[model samples]
Target: MAGARVDPPVHGDPATLGGYELIGRLASGGMGRIYLARSAEGQLVAVKTLLAEGVVSDVERRRFAREVELAQRIDSAFTARVRDADPQAELPWMAIDYIAAPPLSELVRTAGVLPASAVQWLAAGTAEALVTLHGEGIIHRDLKPQNILLPLPGPRVIDFGISHANDLTRTSLTLGTIAFTSPEQARGEPSTEASDVYSLGATLFHLALGRPPYRADSDTLGLLAQVQRGQLDLDGLPKELTALIRPCLAVDPGRRPVPAEMLARFRQSLAGLPVSQGGRRWLPQRWTDLIGAYERHGRDLARGAGIGAGATAEGITVDQRTGMVPPPEPTRVYTQERERAERERAERERAERERAERERAERERAEKERVERERALLAQERLREREWQQELERRKAENKDRERAEEKARERAARARARQHASGPSSASAGAASGTSRPSSRPDPARTPPPAPAPSKASSAVVWLVALAVAALLVLWLATWV
Candidate 1:
C-alpha cells in the first residue's frame, strides 16, 4: 500500500469533531472531509464530518447518518473500525480508527508496479474484505485504490458506504472516480455487489499495470461511455494474473466472480508461495519500509501531540500502540452521581441506626416497667404480711384477756362457795349451843327471865351474819379488780 496522504488543517476545518481533537486533515471530497483526530485517550482516529462549506440540509445529515450506520455494520479487521459517532450533532460526524498505511494508488506511484505474487496477495486481502462487506448487504459503491489501505497485517478498506446514493446526481464525478466506476454505475443503474466486483477488477488492473482500465486523459462523457461499454485494455497484464482478473472485468455482472470465489482463487494461486510469518512479506521491501516509516510517523505524531501520555485517574495505563487513553475514571458528572449515591446510602444507614435505637429504647422502657410492676406487687405483698402479723398479735392479746377473765370468774366462784360453807357451819354451832341452853331453861319456861339468855344467842347469830355480808362485799370488790 501507499503512504497516507495527511494534510495540515485548513481554514475551513473545525478545531475538533465529536470531542476528538483535529490534528490534521486526511482527505476531503465534495460532501465532507475526513480529519485525523485524537481521542480523549490519545488514540488517533479519522473523524468524518458532514459540514463541507454551505448550510447542511436535513437530507445531507440523514445521508451522513446512514453512512455512519453502514460503516458501523462492518466489523471485519480488513476494514477501518468505527470508534464513535454523533449523528444528531449540529455538524454530524463519525470517528473511525486512524489506519497508518498508504493507499494502493500512492503505493503504486511511489514503489512502481507490484510483482505478481504481491498483487495476488493484495487481491486476496481485498476480496476477503469485500466478502465481509457484501455479507452485511453492503455494496462498496465507491471501491477504488484510494479507499484501500495496506497496513502490516493486511489490506484495510476505508470510506465504505459514504454518499454513493447521490453519486449519479452529483456533477462532480471526478476523473479519479470514473475510471473504477462499474458499467452499471456509469449507466445510472443501481450498483449491486457485482458492481463492486467490477470496480475491484478495475482497481487490481490499476495496481498491476500502473494505470486505470480505461484511459483517463479522455473527456468525462467518453470515459463514462467507455466504462458503460466495459471497454478495457488488459493487454500488458501478467499471464498468470490475467486468468483470475480477466473474468472479473467481464461486461456482464453475472460473469464477474463473487468476492468469496475471488478470494479462494487468489489464495489457491498464491498457495505455493512462502508463508508470511507476521510480516508484510507479501509486499516488496521498499513498500514494507514505507509502512514502517508511516507507523513511526504516527507514533511520533502521538508523542508530539502528547496524547494519552499519563495514566488515567482509574490507574489504567494508556494503550501503547495507539496512544489511546481510556475515559477518565471519575468525571465531574460521575462524581456527582457517586456523591448522590453515597448520600443516599448514608441516609439509609442513619435511618437504620435510628430504628435500632428506638427499638432498644423501647426494650429498656419495657424492662423498667416490668421491674416497677414487680416492686409494686412486692410492696403490696409486704403490706399484707404486716397486716396479717398485726391481726395475729391482736388475736393473741384477746385470747389472753379471755383466759384472765375466765380465771378471775373461777376464783370469785370458789371464794363464794367457801364463804357459804363457813357461814353454814357457824350457824349450825350456834344452834347446838342454843338447844343445850334451851333444855336448861325449860324448867323456867313459864318465867319471863329466860328471854335474857336467848337475846345473847340472837346477837351472836346477827354478828355472824354481818361478818358473812362484809366478806361477800369484799369478794365482789376483788372480783371487779380481777
Candidate 2:
C-alpha cells in the first residue's frame, strides 16, 4: 500500500483462502501476494500465499510448510504471530496478525529519513525480534525495511525465518534483496545469524540517510561486489549511532554483533528519553499521522467486510480452529521489558535522593547564616552596655573630686577669718602700750565714729580670693568632663 490506500483485488485474485474473505491486496513479492482478509468470526488477518509460478520444485513447496512450522514457534510481540496455515493446499497459504501500519520502506520514502533517536528505537525493536528468531534457530535472510512494520505501539518484524529457507531451495535471491545482503552472503557463503545483523544495519543506514549502505552502483553485480568488499557509504550518520551500527556492517562476520548485543546498545541509547503511550514518542508527528492513515484504512476495510468497527482478532484462537498448540519459547520480550522498568525505577529513585540532598544543604546554609547574624547583634549590644557602665563610674568619680575641693576651700576661708580677728586686736593693744598712737587714725571707742578695721578688710579679701580660686578649679574640672 502507498500512503493510506491498499490496492484493490485484481480480476485474477482469489476471493477466499483457508475460509478467510480477501478484502484488499496489501503487498506482493517474489513469494506471493499478501491480502487483507477477514475470518468467519469477523476478525482481520493477513494471508500470505505462494504464486502459481513460484512453486516449481518439490523443495520449494516443502519450504512453505517448513516456514509455517518455524514461524509458529516464534511468539513474540515484536514479530507477527502466525494464526493458521495449510501447506497441503494447491497454493499453500499462512495467516498472520494483520498489522495496520506502514512499512518502513514506505515511511522513509514519503516522510524522509528518521532522526537518530527514532532510528535507534527502530533498531531496538528489530533487534528484539531478531533475538527471538535467532533463539529459535531461524535466520531471517531478508531483513530489509519492507519486512518491518511501523505501528504506533511498536515495530513488528514480518516475513521472517522464510527467506533463507527459500534461498536454500531456490535458484536466486528475490528481486531487490541483494542490496541488503551481507558481505559473506554476497560471496555465496551460507547465511548465518550474523547475516541478519548485517541486513539490519543496512536497513538502519537507509532509515538514517534515506539511502542504502552501498549505493554507488545501480546494477546488482556492482552493488554485490561493493558489499563483499565492505565499501559502506556512511558520510552523514550521527556519531552517537556509529558505535552501535558500524560494527554490524563489518566485513568479518565474527566481528559483527549479535541481535542481543544490538538490542542492548540501542536500548541504552534510548534510555534517557521519555516514554509515550503506545511508544510513539520516538517517532515524528508526520510519521504517526501516516500510521493513523493506515489504521483508518483497516477500519474502512472492516466496514466493507460487514464487520463491526471494533472487531479484532483478540478472542479468536488459531489453536482452537487448527488444533496446533505452538510450543512456547522462553518469554524474552516481557522479561526484557520488566528489566527496563526496574532500571527506570532505580534511576528515578536516585534522582529524587539527589534533589532531597540539595534541598537539605540549602536549608542548613540558611540556618547557619541566621545564627551568625543573631550572634553579631548580641555582641554589639554587650559592647554598648559596657561603655554605658564605664561612663557612669567616671561621672561618680568626678562628682566626689569636686565635693572634696569645695570642702577644702571652705576650711581655708574659716581659718583666715579667725587669724585676722586675733591679729587686729593685738595690733591695737601694741599701739596703745607704745604710746605712739597718731592723732585718732583709729576711731576711739568712746567716740561715736565707726571703727576703722583695715587689717580686717584685708583678711576678708584673702578669704574671698581663696573661695574664688576653688570656684575656678571646680569650673576647670567640669569643663574637662564636658
Question: TM-score for every candidate vs. truth?
Answer: 0.58, 0.58
Clashing pairs in 1: 2-102, 2-107, 3-102, 41-325
What's the CA error at residue 403 for candidate 1, in Å? 99
Off by over 4 Å in 2: 1-15, 24-31, 53-61, 166-175, 215-218, 269-279, 305-482
Q: Give the alpha carbon lDDT tens digit for every residue of 211-256 in model 1.
A: 8887433545656788889888777899978877888889999988
Give all candidates' CA lDDT scores: 0.72, 0.73
Q: What local lDDT does model 2 show for residue 348? A: 73
Task: Report the alpha-carbon TM-score of model 1 versus the true structure.
Answer: 0.58
Model 2 lDDT tens row, 291-357: 8877776676677732332333221122111212212222222113546655765887899999999
